[model samples]
Target: MCANKKANDDSLIVAIRDLNTHGQGVGVIENDPSGDCQGMICFVDGALPGERISGTLRERKRNYLIVTLDQVLEPSLDRIDSDCRYFPECGSCRLRHLNYPAELAVKEKHVRDLLSRNGLLGHDSPVFKQIMGMKDPLHYRGKSIFPVTSDPAGSGLLIGQYRYGSHDLVDLHDCHIQSRPALALVNRIRELASRDQVTAYDERTHDGTLRHLLIRTGFSSQEIMVVFVVNDRQADEAITSWLPLLKDTIKPLGFALQSSWINDMDTRGNRILSSKYRHLDGSQTIEEIINGVTYRISPDSFFQVNPRQAAVLFDEVIRAAELQPGERVLDLYSGVGAISLQFASAGKELVPPLEVTGVDRVKQAVMDARANAKINELVNLSFIEADATEWLKDYEDNAENQPFDIIVVDPPRKGLDPKALDVLRESGTPEIIYVSCNPATLARDLALLSDVYGIESVQPIDMFPRTTHVETVVLMSRNG
Candidate 1:
């Protein structure tokens, strides 16, 4: 009887056949002999399609569920060795083990499936073109932010990523995702911390000096910015002495200090202790060239992580806008004026008289956008920093700006706020280009807007190649 019971329990094995939008493996139950007749949906971790694994029953809010892959039974052909040393440990990437070409196919299919489900396009509707592959997938990341930890077992500090899904720090001497220069800097920092005896801040104990190390690099210009985050502003003579050595070794554009104070046991309320930073060579900025146009980037400014793919994404947006030379355009959520600058640069050649207004919530981004306008000497371009929803409300109320020819919106992953969508509908912008990173939220928002606006087309661009994430640009027009 005991052996029979064990066999029945073991018979609950399920085969994972697909991946869900959130990167979870999904599978369906094969039979229902008792006629219970309900399809099974399992959320399996670290399991891919064509893999069969036993699952344990789990209780969700109102439903009983089964998740698989406690141990791998059968592996898929697409699975390959992950290049990153931290692969399974780091939760940031899950599909890294999958072949690169297969990964891109999955991303493309995911986007198409999302749009089709929302009735924005038919399954037979043209597949959005696959974004061209990157010149260098490995070491393409130009920025890395690592948390620092004071090793209780060791004398000095360690800087790296947090352990898989936990707050515990994992010391990384080399990260394959980041640029070669960034890896060198990380190694150098670890060496200097040991030599200077600079203690890393411990979040658990709420003690020590260093908290994080932020490194940003402009690959084209080879400009680097190193910002050290500390818990307090105590002047460590050893660390201060090595500042020259750090500069000499890295040749960074800026070295900044971010100091904070931890008050509560939670460590969430830590306040910035220092607000100043020193610029190397009297410059605290880096330059990135996109599509033959150069733009300056500051520490706080926002720019796309993948520069080459960003250009392709922006090109799709511009094409969908069907921009005419003399048309007036409004760009919302314009980070550092990338889209606006592109339009402004081509204003005279495409349209005899073109005007572009860029709006963003970040003051620094607005300032950078305006600065770029000045540098390019684009007279018809302007930038504003304000709550986007509030600005839309005001624009709706005003008679003059009621019907803009074209409006491009690149909201954050959360998608447009409810109020903003309402205002956008009322404003009656003739054309809108909605760029989104999250498909689930994008589908939800598209459903809301579909009542008033007609989706013309959706173009999905693969920004992060080795992952399931995709950047989608959708074009819509008011329903006539």
Candidate 2:
């Protein structure tokens, strides 16, 4: 049921029948006394499936809404006690109250429903693999960002996530989803911000100093980067003095500053105050090993959040491709060469050599991809920085080499760009593997591509638990 539903004059209590993707309890209003057959749909927070709740009417932009959870009449058998102190407050993991196995099953069902809705699944379609859970749900996040805000009633600062349904910041001393080191650093930063009397940014006045605290860590190396975002360059003195102390305290490999001035008139603007940054030992790279191939990661490069599941996903791709020796493989949207490097390394162990071409729009990512190839000593692999659609157009026009034997596309959440789909349809690449994070978009793209490509199989991998997100890898071949 949709979250936003029109409200009628007469409202009544309703029981939540199930949980939706956004962590809201969904239910249908019964027996419209007003003689309107349209049953009311409501979304209530803090209420579980099979529970009855009393709702209050609230008005929201052309729609009167039922917005309050009065009570829980019944609880589902799946509901368990949340382990973290900030279970629902943290707003990071919504399904922590559910068992791990149940969470996986629900995620798989979501993917299947999406695919079936778009007519991409059929009785003869290949079996959908079971959802893959993370090795450790807690402390799995390698990166986290905290916004700095001032307490309106006081003169000190607070550091943490934004409050639910509002921009207000909530000070969080501990978050179970983040790595232990990250949580530790958050506490340290909060204490330092309070002690130094550093003013947190106030959007209403644009007077406070600090804006945000960004932290990223490499799991393999334990290398860390801390970036302090501020509203103006005038706070350089405070930042400079604090950097040394933070360096000694947190021991991060890199320290940087980014400044943006917030102007009044109820709008937003951003301007980088300091383009310069400092790094310990003058290195800004993180080492990540995927499928036994190590790659260097930079500040803005895209890497899978769940590294272990990423390996499993890539392995599924390789198996689906049935990659033969000496086959020419094209890896599109290959950020930092993770998938390309994995396939190239695997080919070396086989009897024949495999040639790979990796393409991405980000120049830095392409450079890193090439660097990874060099480090792995992959002689037959090459990297190119170009728009995936444009490059595919040019590749089709040139037609210098044999048609690509296998094409792998791991697009962003928006799924493949329409122009890329057009090129793929025209190129007639014998085999295609499409990896996507959003099942709805994947289903839409698959429906479009099914006209020319036959769906061979689909494997859904649970890279994210506790959240409604899922990753799917689909294999298709040219239709006869």
Candidate 3:
């Protein structure tokens, strides 16, 4: 409708060419009235490659235009009727509009292009394995953080996802991608709030009580953890008197409440959990077993959201590590020692066993890692609280500590810091197993390590199906 606006140059008709890193369709429009539209590349949401579509311009910057697909005259074979009630509106599943196969292909290209553009995939592109996806992709998310907002119609609290780029909540009772228990628990939480008149926070006025409902579920155990993120710690009568009502209501659903907590957060910045928290009922930690190692997951712990895909991702990591007995392995940014403990457990079959040391900046995670190691009775694994980069440099100087034969680094999306990459590069470690969530950052870090290590294999695991995000594991071997 706004295409005819003087700023938009009417509209641009372009063939959907490829998908960008964010899963948005990329296309180019040749010389046009808009100053930036001359040979300008365009990205349109919900438009697939090979499909000719008319896109109306929304915003233009430098050499690109953010266009809204006006009409998909020719749709791709991959397009399907989305079963989600809130597809395209809800930001959780960016690729659900595409067929399952197309979603996987988009993620595969995202990883490969990031690597190729950064020079990791040189002359000989390694025979990369096909993307591993879920058999039943829907309702696979084990954890969900649903935003609470005042209903637009002005009746009760509206709880659902925030729109893709804004804080506006798309009122929804259930999500298509939440675990069965998660969606059910959401309904129950909304009911409890309405019945007890729990105040939903408003960002504009900085008022109200409840901010969000944070729920985490154990895939195999079927246990549940619920946390109420409130705007402030000022005691709310609804929370004090109504939590027991909530616990009593959901008990018969076959989902055991392993943990329940109240976390006070800021209305601004859209924070999830704050430092101030109190236990409502149940234990402070929930449990999940991965590869025979039981992890006591705390409320704030950074556990993988998808346990099923997690199992697959971890298996790939273990296979890529190729650890042997008597080897010294260092696990960097090892939250809860999942990777470190898994390696140590696998080494048990080998007579010598691996000497594994895990390091993390968070003392709480290190404590949980120690607890996990004890629970699994893995004697070979040890956890230390320290900054990974500084620790490596220290070990390099201190002869007693010595150098690790192998290293496993599972860094956050920001990837390795430059200083960390420097230490990692000069360490001369024989083998390094890198597990990353963001391909762009992974490629950036790999570029730094390319001189000393050669990327042997690259495996992209579809950890979050229907979403743009992907997890990758790479085996980097020292070059002779």
Better of 2 and 3 by lDDT: 3
Tens digit of lDDT per residue, candidate 1, span 312-383? Answer: 877787778777867988888887999899877766466466788898888889999988778777788889
Candidate 3 minimal-lDDT segment of 10 residues = 1-10
Superposed Cα deviation of residue 293, candidate 3 (Å): 1.5
Better of 1 and 2 by lDDT: 2
Superposition-based RMSD of candidate 1 using all C-alpha atoms, in angstroms: 4.6
Model 3 misplaced stretches (Cα beyond 4 Å): 1-10, 30-38, 233-236, 240-253, 266-268
lDDT of 2 at 163: 68
lDDT (Cα atoms) of all candidates against the true structure? 0.70, 0.72, 0.82
How close to the true structure is residue 230 of candidate 2, measured as C-alpha lDDT? Answer: 70
Those runs of model 1 whose alpha carbons end farther than 4 Å from true positions after fitting are: 1-12, 29-39, 54-71, 131-135, 235-240, 247-282
lDDT of 3: 0.82
Tens-place lDDT digits, model 2, residues 1-480? 213324544444666776677777777655334433235676777666676666554433233234566445566677788886766776677777777777777777777777887666852355676676777776666567687787777857778887666677777877766766666667776777777787777777777777776666666666555666676655556655665555455455342221111212212354422444434332566666777788776655677776656788888888888878889899999989989998898887666789899999988799989998998888888989999889988988886857789999999889888898999999868999998888888888999998899887878888777766778888889999
Best by lDDT: 3
Off by over 4 Å in 2: 1-18, 31-38, 47-52, 59-67, 123-126, 234-282
lDDT of 3 by residue, 1-480 (tens): 122335435567767789876778898764345544545688999888788887777787666778888888789999888888888888787877789888888888878888889656853486466778878787777778888987778777888898887778887766667887777777777777777677788888998888888888887776888888988765466666666665665577677777888887864875677888788888888888787778788888878888777888888888888777788999999998878888888887787888889999999899989998898888987899999999889888776766789899999999999999999988978999999999999999999899899988988899888888889999999999
